[model samples]
Target: MRSKGERLRRRRSAGSRLSTGSASELQQYSELLHASPTNPYAPFDSKIDWEVARWAKLRGPGSNAMTELLKIEGVCDSLGLSFKDTDALNRMIDNLPGRPAFKREEVVIADEAFEVYHRDVIECIRALYGDPEFAKDLILLPERHYADADKTIRMYSDMHTGKWWWNTQKAVERETPGATIVPVIISSDKTQVTLFGNKTAYPIYMTIGNLPKEIRRKPSQGGHVLLGYLPTTRLEHIVNKASRRRTLANLFHSCVSRILRPLKKAGEFGVPMASGDGIYRRLHPIFATFVGDYPEQLLVTGIKTGECPKCPVPHNELGEYGDRDKLRDIEQVLNALSSITDGNPLVFVKACAAAGIKPVQHPFWEGLPYVDIFQTITPDILHQLYQGVMKHIISWVTKACGAAEVDARCRRFPPNHSIRLFTKGISTLSRVTGREHSQMCQILLGLVVDVCLPDGHSTATLIKAVRAILDFCYLAQYPAHTDETLNHLDEALQQFHQAKHIFVLLGIRSDFNIPKLHSLLHYIASIKCFGTTDNYNTEYTERLHIDFTKDAYRATNHKDEYPQMTKWLTRREKVLRHEKYIKWRVAGCPPPDVPQTDGMPDPRDLGSRPHLRMTRHPTVKAVPVSTVKLQYGAQFFEAAFARFVVQYHEPRWTAFQVEQAAANIYLPFQRLPVFHKIKFWIKDPFHRGLGSETSDAVHCSSIWA
Candidate 1:
């Protein structure tokens, strides 16, 4: 009898053979490309004639295996193209004399290059589908789209750099997530044109990043690829040549409107435009405007103002504007945009030149049929929070305060006990807070407890102000509380501005200006107007670009970088799709659930403590409180140095947990003996508050008073 391992191997081998045989059978159903029966080695262009003949000779005379696959009837068909058997052809090509290289001189025109790729990309897109839930619901219509453009330099040589890109959308649903489908490349032969406020024409390059279904079928078998490049061109190439003023908005409108016109027409088709493999996608107009960053928005929209383009108030040079009398509303913003004369460059330019309020010149957004400036522009939350405020404030805190605290404490303790702040700086802050501004408020409150900072200290005040804004972001979800939160945030902002000299007092430089520190202010009003902070956030879009950057590191050809990006995107999508399919299969037939284990009963029950029912859990027995992590309403505090004692667990209460405690349990970290009951939402602690002690007893308010 064969060994069990040998029997298993034989079974696996038989299964593989069966699968391969079935795949071949399925390929027979493909008629277009597979049944063409043309010579595979035939060359379409004279440029590859020498290579073609060598391939024929390598296959040996009359073997017919090396016949040009391209010339095969129906072989070029989308369905047939995917099923082509390239093993024989690949083997033949591998034995050729030298590796293939790009012939740049033979490159097609940018417009022609874009069309060839766009046609195939559109075909592929038509085959895939979007989340039906997102498409059907009007509320979710805004969620289905995000538009942002970024330029990355592709080096052909040390001195020669080219840029190209195409607009595309990625599908995200719980079941089949992260499917990036490429859209058409919007490029033209006349790539450069001067726009309003520009002295020269800016060159245009639109490269669609998508991979053929054939290539994407099995990405893991080989190294990842980045191959779908429409063409390469430069932005500054035309800008450098133009000697007259050009408006960026005009150029964007002229180019994009033309591109969208075709797509707008395509949306009328009743048949799901693109459907295959049980997935379908629709070509629809984008609703949200999620651009790369503030500068890009300013450039693209022809709005020179550094403040948010949608702000109703006239933002100052410092990008700071807040008026109690003139709170932001859609009506006021529309009136301001309407003041800019349509198509009259002189009038718009003169309006922009005025100091207080500048007029928006973009014809595409400002007074377009039903759309208003408020709907067209949105503040980038990622840049405002993570890259901007969180990063800057953390830097200021570390340099001016955290470092001092660390140094002061380090010398007093042993090397092992030496205190250090979060080593990753703002990144650590971001990870802890994430999208929850309330959680950030918790972290900020922790800083006070961690460093033993007094409540009235300037640094403490700054943190408070920062937390106030974060809390506003967190609590803004409640429509009833939105105005209240905004008011609190305004107060916090004022306090922070008043304490500007505090940074200097803490040894920060004198040149620190409030305007530079106030970029976060622009996002607040917009948040109230938009109903959520996520509406304008670039967190997802920026993350996608980050993935692109990381994948680009694998590219060997610096000159032709677009193809590498396309290949990476395709491979990533394929991997995600395969994973989704596997998950779907598993979901249909779920594994048996593991038996549940009984957890140890509360220790108090096993012990002689008959009073355990008085509290949710047992309170630590008379132990000194090393760190008092307390929550009172939305307020959260984690104090490492503040001292108190575990008197008793306060019995469950509807609104508050009052603890009667003795002060100065630890001499160095002592606090007032006056007992207090902390009030906070009950559900909050379960979600975020971990390792906190339940109050042992109800504090007597009258006794403390």
Candidate 2:
């Protein structure tokens, strides 16, 4: 066993050498933890109390090692094990050295215990096993900080965001097109006012971790990481338009400059960039911008457009772009924005000037890849669809739509037995938000022409047009239909434009004219060119900021918040790295299961279809027919057999359901019951695709005709 001082010295020495790639760093950290007989990095051990206590004291005041010892003792006692006697523990606690006074008392004393733990234990591990220059990379002292400044911040690098970008980039590159280099998608949004209690207004930008697989896939999963933040208080100081514009421009420039630094370095060095850069382009500039509201979009692009920002189409008030496909030119838009002059000073000049300590640039026009800017800065689906169009339409229909009684009107689809019967099941506008309204749109659009309205009359046609626009929000599940979906959406928007006068009858005019409503026409084109709405939307970015706001609020010290934030973020990285290391060590190749089935289900299948069954299992006498939808790991079963089994249940049910069922049953079930194990072969009569494939009774047991 080593003394506390000896371990500290060892960690400090080893920490310096951990400046390598993630794998090498992990290995080095693992080796350092194993250097001492009692590894501090490992799960808690009561036996190492003296060393642990001493380590805590090194962190700062307020960490009573005695409390930690007590916690360990309590855990041991709960497990019916004996802990070191209280007298011995007291002796150890009493002898522990006093907490060291780090220059900043406020920073050392965290508002929460987790902060303390992160600062003490996690940070020590990070310092020892992680990037040694993590803190140094963000903070600059002597030159930047005041003479008396205990802590000063130059910048903050969020570790989780970095890791996510790294991991996601790796996955995408490895799994998808290896040669294609996608630029980072940076999403910015103003968080809820007072989201951080006293720290009310924190507007932040984040790096999206993953790219959606295809046009239909939503890029909402895989948490986005923060790249930059601006406090509203800072904005309040720039009262005059010139100063305000300059300050905002500076803030945007500095933040973007930092983000682009790695890529820029890569460009200079002729090396692939850091944090998931590709060989093709060393500096993949900001190609996509996802923003919550219109103001942020204005800030990013520095210009408001009369037409859709994405396509070469002219904007129409009725949510339609006629046969004209003239997308706005990036250069033209940039010229328009740069043309604005305040007292002979061009806005561009003021924006790019180094008026403050840091230099500024037009983040979108100047900072972005020139060719990508046109489609890069477009409408966010979250605000445009749910919060914008859906919200507006619902509010209008329920409140001001020329219906005598809102409830009675929405509840009944206007008359004619010749038309489709409308389901009055949609809730009142007050009860549902934009997401729900989009879902309703999906259901309404799927109805047959006669079923959608009272008659094939003009009123019914108008209602159909309205629903069609909402239906456009849903990206088609299959790639083949995506283009068709976009075309249909365009046609629907055109029809809406032609018949928008119907909304006037419903007393909905001004609301229909919002740019987002018109911009919805471009989503299909975006998906066709870029990917899913998630690929460039701010949904994930906004959600991640909620957590960041909480973390920022925890650090009450605003004077040197950058240092505190770096520490917090680095600690988080160390924790995630440790977890990932453990996972890699423990994880084996995933047991062979089913190949993912793509595309829409075969159109031949009808409702209440018969079930398919599998024939074999190593453990069970007969595998369940329900297992046909699951991944088969049986050595006796061939890959073809596995695919056959999976396809039988999959097109009828979703691939998601099939995978989920595999996890639920195939992964856990030791053996299937005889009843579930019953197997048979079912053939499709409609398609005449005669197959000798197996079928299960268990799956179709519920679908008795």
Candidate 3:
């Protein structure tokens, strides 16, 4: 034997490491003893230490070298096995890896194949072959050799197969446009590498060495090697297409599933696909279909859509990494967290702390408590904060129209979160504050415009801010303010469009450009264009801060000037219904409560619906815009106001609003939103009588609904 071989031989026969038998006898016995448990030495009572020893001896000295023979005896016996044939000897050898370790082996990884060297791996195998039984039962996969230019070696194996795994029958499971296979999982890693695509067609080959000296020393070990090759590229093509055809709701339902892990509260939402990035990335393709375009950017998940910042930072330690892959900081932070949690956490308080992962004195920790009214904030705290922010913004705006302080506040707040909270405060307090449209527009304008667009933030982060702002505008009950906010918005939007177009245009990334942004923008334009005070015969729409209590509609009773609140609410109901219908069609089913209409039209495919044409509103008109419906809208609001006050017992809304409502919803010159327009009389509001007929006769409109 060569020097390395002699060292291994000397080490193996070290008497303390190997059994009393010669190497051949030891190998033979080890193999028999460790043979699949079904062939256990059924002659002894496993509970006896002597019986366990006898069984181990019976099993042979092959590779089943016993170190802590007693510890593993219980496990072996339960598995219907005697200790003679054991994996213990292999493990004991590994516990001492420094003995001539790293000697080159018959095991060589090259040319898409692995080899076992004559001197090393073979010697290890020879040591393992002391017993005939275990040796006969075990066989490493054959070497890979490409027989021709087109031929390639492929291999596969999985452990712990459950009922879901094998059918002896290989079949394709259908998801969107094609059939796919979800293969059985074989191992566990803290952060797993998930390979997406149809698992059935993808061959995953793994190799494990029967070496006794290696596994115990290296805990971060790979028992197997993985291949990134697939014979056909067809799996990629099919998976991509199927993902593109799915709806956001359905796509989420299809590819990824969330588990209520025992991490936080009653549970935490754990990403099931964490073990494999390939599987998680497939989620992006599905979201692409929802946007009607590829997403330019998307967070890794739980960043925007998840419940607050509630993820546990793992055992991490941060580093000052000069490289661009910024995860180094997170890694260090995780290690510190692990040290605190003692490597595992099962309860809520600890879970929350783990999720926050903040060191006791971190600066960001203080502001987190007041983040939202939804989680732990009491009603009192919520009310106080709401009032405080609104009042504070107003006082600041009044005192510092051009003050450097005002500009500084706007600049200091990141486009993320701080601005979103400001916007949410504005929207929530609109009914209470009675702030003027024009002044509100400018304040909002200032915030959106002040963010110095920097490569300093992720593009995904910027898009989130933009989306939040757009949603805030819509929810504030002020669709007509869009064009008014236009110039401000266009400038803000320019930052996102110009710099992000490259990725947004390509299908490669999916962090930016989701459906809600564009759809909400489009709706804002649609409603604002048609709903104006021109119909109310009021010219004050152009003013910055017309006090609502002092508007012309108060004197006019605004019946003739604004659209009815009843009409507007009725229209909103329709939009909701239409959205519901679109969701169903995409899911290839009917929405619940949807009556069989024999041939109810698909909402998303409604390209042929005949809508009454209203050409009166001039195209391209901006804020406080006028459309033909304004003429009839004034009359509409008068009727709507009378209707609203009587039916719902709602407070006397400012005449300013009554007039705006009339111009927006009731007139025939312009129809309400689509779902209502499509089946206006068909859908009934909860507990309300049929369509506008009864509403018209009673002079009652419902703002509450």
Candidate 4:
């Protein structure tokens, strides 16, 4: 006889093949996508899920961690209507896996890790129903109803909470000494029988649109699934707690009466068990920025190799000139991912990789992280990869901070002073304790700049970072990565017109002195007003931080700056294809217009020495060519470095890339051959923070302070 696992795998494979034929049945499986979503379909885009799913499949077992990370970001972006950053992502990652037994193909989790333990239920269900029955039931599963989000337990027909949800009154009635339904609905998505005192019935409700593709009448093969089940009273109590609504306040704009669902005494959904994991996450947004593990020196980009030179793993497998081992480790982790029947597989393999114990070392423990073997592995990789786990950490952090609503706690719409409070707190904390302002700045910017996108414009915060730091200079420095940062930047830029003046008020930007940038901004407005059709709502090139809603908001109010930009317009630049910054895709080439040498030319100083400085330059025509865009996943740092070099009479182009499979992307400027040519750059280990505002201010401040 095949082992139980093989039996289950065989059953699932057949079930999948059977289920694939019917489009309706396949469509029903999408509920699984929404149930345990990596993100909500933001901007009404379903492709994001496919992108996330593709990433997960490619990354292997580690892909689940990536999946969870994506889910956290997607959840935050879709639900809160905000963004996050890498620092915030790290904090959130640390908070997960708080319970036990995690997996990928969850039907429902009936225990401590009910939130993630749905696969067990699914497995049990598959075992109960033969492969065909299992496949058919998946077709009948409900379409993901966003309105009922708090209702369903993602993967499992009814996760533990789902079981409780299905048998809510039954669980209440059974007060029965020991009774729990072995989820027939879970193990196989195609089946829907739950054991209620040996009488199996499809107790769960199903919505109209999402249903099984095929309907099966015969029970076939094993008529009843036998589960040598045990009932635990302690677990029963826990399920009751887990059954509590997920963010009632968030879900229901109107408050629910205490009589309907009693609130926990601690005023939370659940109480802390041992050490509360996310205190850092909960508090850090208020404090601002995380202590990022920014390496003091270059990452061992295959030059030094990921292997501990002496430890003797084959270093050749990892590509030279980059941390290919990290990539290999990432791939290895993805491949090994099984459901969390044991535990977090990503963390498990990560520990192995960090300790130099490759896949061959713990072959059986490939995708599952069981404590027996996992305990033996070193925790360094598990430790380092935490940063990459929660993608939009910053946005969540800002929200959590705002959730405190400390400044105007009870108001319907609080002042939303989270950023200002964080900045003020940092200033206060730094001055009183003589904390290094640079370090403090680094933490804040790591969350802000490194995490968020579109650098430093008012759109930095997912919790509306723009309105909070009105008229501030944009903080454009790269900080640590997290989930919310990129999401927040995208969302904020989507609503750029709403955040613009606030950025200016914060003095984050010098109003464009060149009419070219202004005209570009105007053209962007016109395109927004008109339509780019294909790339409509695309986030690139024309993303401006403008919020037209404010009562007192106004443009920079200087025609001199506006009209003066005519020169840049005159530069014969028709470089429109960089909208998505695609290289090979677009046709035609306009020499990539290097940013003009002039600094922020004030409208007031316009025809003065600053103005004369531009026209009166020695007749050296133009400077010699430097480098072109080498491929990079990182553009923020290189973009800044490129401009920095020209200011100090230096020239170099830098590209960013992933390092050691770590969350942090490397600028690798110092690694380039023309590294010496980047004279205008700065290292800033101490911390001014992320984005243009902090970059401009702290660079100015560090020079002064």
What TM-score would every model get versus the actual structure? 0.43, 0.53, 0.18, 0.17
Give residue 683's lDDT in candidate 3 (0 to 100): 28
- Sorted by lDDT (best first), the order is 2, 1, 3, 4
- Model 2: what TM-score? 0.53
The lDDT for every candidate, in the order shown, is 0.33, 0.40, 0.26, 0.23
lDDT tens digits, residue span 1-705, model 1: 222223322432211111111211112212212322343222111214423333333223332343455547774453233223334433433332221111121222212222211223223333222211112211111111111122121111100010111111212112122222232222221211113322211222222213221111222211122212223233343454332124333444443343333333332221233221223333332222323455555544444444544434444434243442232355544454455647675655554544223343333333322233343344455555555555555556556546556344333432121123333333334334334432233344444334543334555555554565445344433222233455665676666555555555666546433322444464444443333443334443433332334343233244444444344344334333322222323344311121111122322122233322343333333322322323222122222222122323323432222222222224453232323432222222444322122423332232112
TM-score of 1: 0.43
Better of 1 and 2 by lDDT: 2
Q: Over 4 Å off in model 4, which ranges?
A: 1-126, 131-135, 139-364, 367-410, 414-705
Per-residue C-alpha lDDT of model 2 across residues 1-705, encoded as one tens digit per residue: 222223322433211221234333334545644523343324324334423333333232232443555567465466432334444433433332211111211111112111111122112222321222121221100011111233321211111111223232333334322212233455556555343455444434443212222211211211234444443434554468666665665455444444444443221222222221101122222233444566666565544344444554434443445433345555554554454434345554544332211123445335333234555554477777777776666554444323344334334654332232334544433556545655545444333233322222355655655565555555422222333455665676666666656566545564354677766665555544444454455555565654555455444355646445544444334334343333333343211111111112322233334454455553334555455335342343334444556667676867676655554433335344332234445555555332123343422221211
Per residue, candidate 3 scores C-alpha lDDT tens digits across 156-190 of: 11110111111110111111211111111111101
In the order shown, the candidates' Cα RMSDs to the true structure are 20.9, 17.5, 31.8, 30.2
**Two-way lDDT contest, 1 vs 3, winner:** 1
Q: Candidate 3 — worst ten consecutive residues by lDDT sum?
A: 283-292
Error of 3 at 306 (Å): 18
Indicate which candidate wins on TM-score: 2
Worst 10 residues of 1 by lDDT: 157-166
